[model samples]
Target: MAHIHLGEGSFPLWALVLWTLLGVGLISAVVYRVRKGGIKTHQIALAGIGAAASFAIFQLNIPVWGGIHMNLTGLVGILAGPLLGALIALVVNIFSAALGHGAVGLLGANTLVNASEAIVAYYAFKTLMGMDWDVFPASASAATLGLSAGAFLMGAIIVISGVNGSALPRGDLTVAVAGLVGLNLGVAVIEGLLTGFIVQFLASVRPDLVGLTDRDTREETTGVTA
Candidate 1:
């Protein structure tokens, strides 16, 4: 939802370098964690499933104000967990760029934005679940938080890049950030509902996959102990 679809030259070289470094570091951490977890068959399958879902769903593109569209990144995170979620987001962004949904030059920044949303969504959901909350509401809140973070990151990037000018013109940057935040605040509700319902359904039926069942909880505890 907070994807930066700008073309080349959207960001200065320094900003690009910083974002690229952050993206690389995050991806590296994802790779390390995935490898440490031994890359289970279920994880691989879920990654493919989540990535496909994200790609297909992003095309829905409900035309919101300001050229922004609703996205299902939180749902992908709920399905794939953090590491696989970020990996799947990277795959989605790359494929989307190839398909002209975004620019190649913006891939690093977009990947970081999407991956942060996914990682936040995963952990937020897990934390809420640990607190004995109902799945739907918990998921909805987590999705909202995830999308909010992504939106804030997008605004920060724009501001730090001088709002595409020599300096961040205070008025223009304020208006731009206000618009971005307002649009995302509305879209976050849509995303949250979508994620909440889907996650609720999955938790009800395939609770093992979502770590919602007692058996899965016990195994998770045992793994931590081991």
Candidate 2:
């Protein structure tokens, strides 16, 4: 929002397509690796933070356009890390498309931008949490940092798409770029807060929900204390 052109470099249609393909391919590889690592640890909820958490996120939304909306993807990323987060995104995006939030063509781009927020949230918070104090910094930091970056990523795509697409008007593109960014600021904050809260909650209530988080904790503790 601060600059109309700020996001103009990221979301061209072809670029989005490429990004989606790359993400799917990359995550697929990670998933394979994780599967080989061993079976899932029980007591860890896959939907994370838990279904209650997802339900909680569903309750929050920022209205945009005549038909669009935005909310936090922070929890998903935090729980899944990039790879699993992207997988969750793929499922959610599919459902959203069926419900008319977006078309199929743009699904990849959406996942690319938003899922990164989750991955960032997961790792950033997960790492900070290692310092102790009950995940205070992880909770406080992930949402703000991850969502801010996610907002920028999403904003970038909208601008680039306008430049690349034959169907979009130049003026409309600029307006959308600025408007979405401004609109996204509040949403990003909410996302960040939500991410932090959820991370802390799960870490306390059901830490196993975070597959990647637990693994890292084990590795760090083992490496340092050993």
- Output the number of the TM-score-best candidate: 1
Predicted candidate 1: what Cα RMSD to the true structure?
A: 4.4
- RMSD to the true structure for each prediction, in A, is 4.4, 6.2
Distance (Å) between predicted and true CA of 208, model 2? 4.9
Candidate 1 per-residue C-alpha lDDT over 62-92 given as tens digits, one digit per residue, 9 for 90 to 100: 5554367766888778777888889887888
Q: Where does model 1 exceed 4 Å of error?
A: 62-66, 163-170, 215-226
lDDT of each: 0.81, 0.58
- Candidate 2 residue pairs in backbone clash: 7-156, 11-157, 77-118, 78-122, 139-196, 143-192
| Sliding window of 10 residues with minimal summed lDDT for model 1 | 161-170
Q: What are the per-residue Cα lDDT tens digits for candidate 2 across 23-72? A: 57756775796678643444234554433444344434434442223344
Backbone clashes (count) for model 2:
6
- The C-alpha local distance difference test score for the whole of candidate 1 amounts to 0.81
- Kindly report which residue stretches of model 2 are placed more than 4 angstroms away from their true locations once superposed: 1-16, 48-61, 65-72, 131-134, 163-175, 207-226
